[model samples]
Target: MFLLSQAQMAKNGKTSPRPRNNVVYQDGCFFIVDFLRFSVPQTTLCSLCPGEEFVRLTITMAATGPAHSTAADSTSASIAPSAVVAKPCHNCRRRRLRCDRSLPSCQKCIKKGEKCLGYGKLLVWNRGVASRGKMMGKSFHVPDQAAASTAASGNQELCLPRKYRFVPSNMPDGEAEAEAEAEASGDEGETSVSINPCLVDPLFQDLDRASRFYISHFTDQMCRDLITYDVPRHNPYRGIVPLIRDHALLLHVIVANSAIHISNVISKGSGLLNGVPGQYPQHDALMAKQKTLQLLNQAMNDIDAVDPEVVLTAILLSINYELVSSGKDDWKVHVEGAQKLIDYFGLSKRSDLSSAMSALRDHVVSDCLIYYILGSTFSARQPNMGSMTSRYPFLDVLPLLERAEANSYMSCPAFLLQIMLSASHLSNLDVITGFEEEQAGYLMERARTFNIDAWAASVQGISSHNDFESRVHVASAHKSAVCLYIHQAVPSANLMDDDNRKRIVEDIIGHLSFILPGNLLLKGTSWPTFIAGAESRDPAQRAWIVARLNDLWEMLPWGYVHTAIEMLKAVWAMEDTAAETTGGWLKKLKGLGNDWIVV
Candidate 1:
């Protein structure tokens, strides 16, 4: 047997030269032939020597391993070899071999005839290399995954965060998910109108912050003005935040309203109108309103594609926008639009009142009634629904009035609707001439005979209940105002003496204090205050009414409030100059062509 060092064999040209200081040599009567030089296969090299020689060579090779590459040694210098480094498979680590660290398996194990141990401590790149564009030589577009998903699904409005998604109270989880998926895929045969991407993208980009702002304002501030009664179930703005996220148009309306509200608050605090700071820009709000109007027109034109909730919310928000910002009578157009939607849905005809009338419908109808009544009160024309009894024969106004007299919150609005209906008819009477004047006399007689004292007495029982107090106070105040309206409409009638009329006006002024200045119920007392202010003969009472009007203007800043205040001021000026009655003030107001509707 002959032993050859790798260097000696290489010098003799028997082996190819390499760093082989650690290579092993065994006993062999061997021909000093290199496998690479002689073209001998590796498998045959062991057989060329005897079995004992091969076994001895294997033992020697195990003792003195092959030389390590400088690259691997330097790269792994930071980590101890036995420290169980991550990223490499267990098999590769155990064999002290390099690992490619590919997922599932590595290449080192397969080449070495060993089973591949799976990867260890997988590390994910959250912000991929593409996000660090500076590291790359050229810029590449990493498309927004959310935008792409919304585009593919064709439901840009549905890309809200989970926290903002409002699941309806009645919707099942499975059905809701199915519906969402269907909506995302546009499977309901709904009309697909492509809104301007510019109008939608920026809103969605800041949706989280915008949603929080609007929802906070709605719950804390807006609800105070919206829900005057204790009928929580019938309040339309309840649980409307999530709905705002579901529809783009509704979201715009809410944001627009929120912008106006923020502006008002800032204006009140700083006494600066243009420099008010807020997340929603004033221009954005104005643009949103314009967009909302455009979308509303489209929805109205495409009747089949109109979403009832969207239309209803849009109309309500538009009305509020007009009240907060424009303070114009453009809100009447929205009221009429809401009426068209209500009629389209046949909400009044549905048999199951609870199931058929959603909170949105209740809000729409109530708002329409309030606006229609106010508009008819001052306008020269009358509404088509002449009387509550004639318009809704099924709805018994007598029971509703009795229930209201019992201080039932649910019945108060219905009762008020009845009063407004009758007032609407009597308001149009040509009392200057004798045209249908007897009908006015009959309405005045009914109003005088109505037991308002009983209703006021019923509120006394519930006045102690904190939850019910505000609503009761507002109801009583509105009832007093209605009585004052009846007197003002037919002051010449002998149903009540001059003393009784003065007592009614004093009662209205007294009731107005309960919901004046800071109270949310003050929103519903504007018209009543106007009526009482016009009739107030005493300087102290007239000053108090004017102060309340000023407070309302300071808080809401609506144009109508300003108009009402101006009209009241003119009436007060006339009364100071001469003893002007409520009818005389009305005549002066009519002569000025100022058909002021205060509510």
Candidate 2:
């Protein structure tokens, strides 16, 4: 390799206008300079562009000088033949510092406490000086002393180093000759690097196809359910595609999700519930998943390697992957990992990132809140909602929610989530009897009358489009679910009649029916649907709930959904056996330690 600098090119007048035909541009421009001969007849080519500078090259040379030399006289001319070498150790080269080339190890690396990456064989230009002469429109030949010496000594190893040796494999003679000719006529002294023919074409071609598939299908197809309401003028996943492309970890996660989703569709079409046994291998998907996990683990450990956007993308993709694949709860691990990263970066403490990142930050925080509420509500546990709201001050703050509403796509309604969290806290309190129970009943009554219509109207005022309308439906469903949960917490015989409870369940089911059919709001509806299903005494209504869940499972089959289905069945069975009301069944279900949360 030859190192060229823009300052050197400027000093040598290499940037001056020249004949355009003389300059060759492959991926970029290449300037062919004249050969400068030494005792060794080696040729090297260096390319540089004037407008786009900052190019450095590495060239390997044979050792030729004594070992000991002063720093001032370390140049090629001052060093003895045995001391001067072509390339420095890898560590020194990376640091752009001089190397005192030594066998097995380098002194510079040892002094700096770095591992010395060993030197490899030197790459000699096979065409020699004749190729340079041909480029210059002249006839010249340089005898190959190395080849002649090897032939004379009957030692093939002396002709070329093992690392630089190349042998063609499985190619027709005509094709091999044509390839050789092409290499010869290409840029002079530039080595041709080839990969394994069998591996290169298929692997890279599949990667290209997968990348295109993700770009075209992933955002619209997979993300539509997650983000039901469209932002003002932005595609949520589109803005992050470039970031995913630039990050290996994030890209791997996306590729994994894409491959798994495709595999699932193919499996379903082929009458394979899981996958073909020892046939129709999912190598790409499996490899991508494995690599993503490896890289994600590595990234999590390295502070400098982890970025908030990258972590958030990986979390979302991992969640998507979990939903589509065989039901698994590993997505919770990813969510927890994202929470750790958010805390590490102090993303929840302040909104000081760039506008784009701030939007992402809001979305991430919203997702966290949604999951937290779902977990607490479904499991009959209370989360530290106050702490969460304190960390992310915008969770309950109306002004910040309205300000960010236009930019945050796929985010849960902050006001509704806060109400649900408050209800969950009240549910977890020990207010079953006496003065505390009376006070709690009063508070629950106040919560039930919280003016949801006014809130919905305020949100609708922001945008009256279909997207906002969908959000209004989701908010109403969640508010109904929160009320149901609060009532379930205080199991009073006469607080609400059986007809009144049935009405509440019907209202929630009606609100959810608007968006749940399309699976548009599945991520935020699990808790609501569970509560509604648990409360519904009508066989037809229960069947409808089961059917809707089954449909949702077919769309996004997360492990938690399967668990929720099993728990719902248990609740229904207990109600049948004990002839108990929905509230009594829920109390017994909670006692049985069957708390599974889905979001």
Candidate 3:
């Protein structure tokens, strides 16, 4: 009966199983029950003294309730599966903070009883506040000090340069370092038309020192490559072999300066031809081989020992090889050389070497004019479309021309004519080589607009003494037209203006008048021989120049026409002056009869 009563009590949640007859009671998640242990009290009257102790409680089921319960309670309750427990601060979350349920850090956690927990979101807010505080300090306080600290901090992590301390390489020795310095410091403007400040004013670096500096900077291998190879890829030029010749000329200057031993060794291998060793060779074959070596040696020697001005002059003389083509056969060779010269002289990008030639100011104009000659001429004779410039690419001289325009260089009719000739050459080469008809036509049209051929045709009438003045007048008038037309065509683009045009033509006229008689024409030289020589030497160029002169004359004002006629009459009457003059003059004059052949 007692067992049945106990079972009913257990079912009614009144009792739970106890081990070793120990009674248990309930706490929240724990149970505490007490059973009597009989012991004699001090009075020895009580069978069991009143006592309490904790015992294990067995829970059959748990019911939900709020988590903040205090003092153990036994009741029917359950926890919903969806209920969430609040989290603590960030640091606390990572450290699993023990919550004191305070604002930021719990008091217990703050007190080091455990990590105090606040809401993780509140921790983020505190960090933002701290960052703001730091920013305020930075802004209101020592800015330089803060910057220095920042820079110092950055220095610790990065390998940034503090100053320009150049440590040159030891191996493969040469003036490479010097060259680099020159490249860094040298005016990028030096080129064919550039006037060297040193040459003109001497305030610039000494020309001799500068040249030596450059020579030393280039390595032996680099010098050799420039001197020996770098020939035009095209065939006829490859055959004529002007590339090495031009290089040899430059080397001659260096050798003449006694700056390099290498040039002497190479010059010995170049055998003497029909001409004297030092003189300019007349024959093409000799020019390509022997004369090339001679010029190079001379140039080198000049650079080594001569006056810096002389050296500068030598440099110009040697570089002129880039200007002259290998006749009509290997025109591409000259064109390529010019392009390379522009690159070599640091004029490849459209900019002035000096503010000397307004024509050169237009980089696109210059390049378009110059590069096309190479691009076109190299492909001139080729039958295969694949080998031609037109097939593979189109030249863009416009940009260079535009650059010249910016620098006030596109002012000369002669300059414009050069550009036109280049275009025409490209067009003719394309047509001759059977390139696309459309491209050829386009190039032809471009050529006609510049009126280069007309100018060339015009210049033929003027004789040597008056060629200069006559050439200038014709070039000025025609150039004016060109500038006007170009401006009309491209109104927004700054083509050459009237003032610039006049300045350039006047400059050319002044230069020609100064140089032609003193330098080119002498008292006894044959007019026909002179004419023939000039024409044969540079048929294309001479033709073009002559044409420009003719155009200038045609466009001359009425007063100039009468002056030109008087000048012609004077040339015709030279014989009368010779007869009337002294014996010495007569002897000089006698040579004039041999100068011309009526046929």
Best by lDDT: 2
Per-candidate local distance difference test: 0.55, 0.56, 0.31
Off by over 4 Å in 3: 1-319, 322-334, 337-347, 350-599
Which wins on lDDT, candidate 1 or candidate 2?
A: 2
lDDT of 1 at 10: 46
RMSD for all candidates, in order, please. Answer: 15.3, 23.4, 25.5
Candidate 3 has what TM-score?
Answer: 0.23
Pairs that collide, model 1: 2-28
Best by TM-score: 1
Q: List, residue by residue over 577-599, the lDDT tens digit for candidate 1.
A: 87545555555555554445666
| After superposition, candidate 2 runs with Cα above 4 Å error | 1-208, 211-216, 230-233, 263-287, 326-328, 380-412, 426-443, 461-464, 467-473, 490-497, 513-526, 550-563, 579-595
In candidate 2, what are the lDDT values of residues 87-201, reduced to their tens digit? 6877778789888876445767766777666465445555433445444333333335764554566431112221221222323578658766865687765443322211122
Tens-place lDDT digits, model 3, residues 1-599: 00123444444464653323322212312222221133111111111112222323222211331232112221212211222235444555577645434332344455566543334334334322235543322222223454457565643221112222222222124555655566557675521221221122222123333233323322222222221122223111111112223343443343222222222223334331111222111122233334444553564454445322222223332332221211122223333433433443334353434343222233322433433432232133321222123432323333454333211212233345443333333333312333333444443345345654454344433221234443344344434333332332222233345465345434333333332333212111111121221212234533433443333223221122222233223333553444543222112322333211110
Q: Which stretches of model 1 miss by more than 4 angstroms?
A: 1-216, 229-235, 270-275, 278-281, 351-357, 383-413, 431-435, 448-473, 491-498, 514-520, 551-560, 574-583
Alpha carbon lDDT at 89, candidate 1:
80
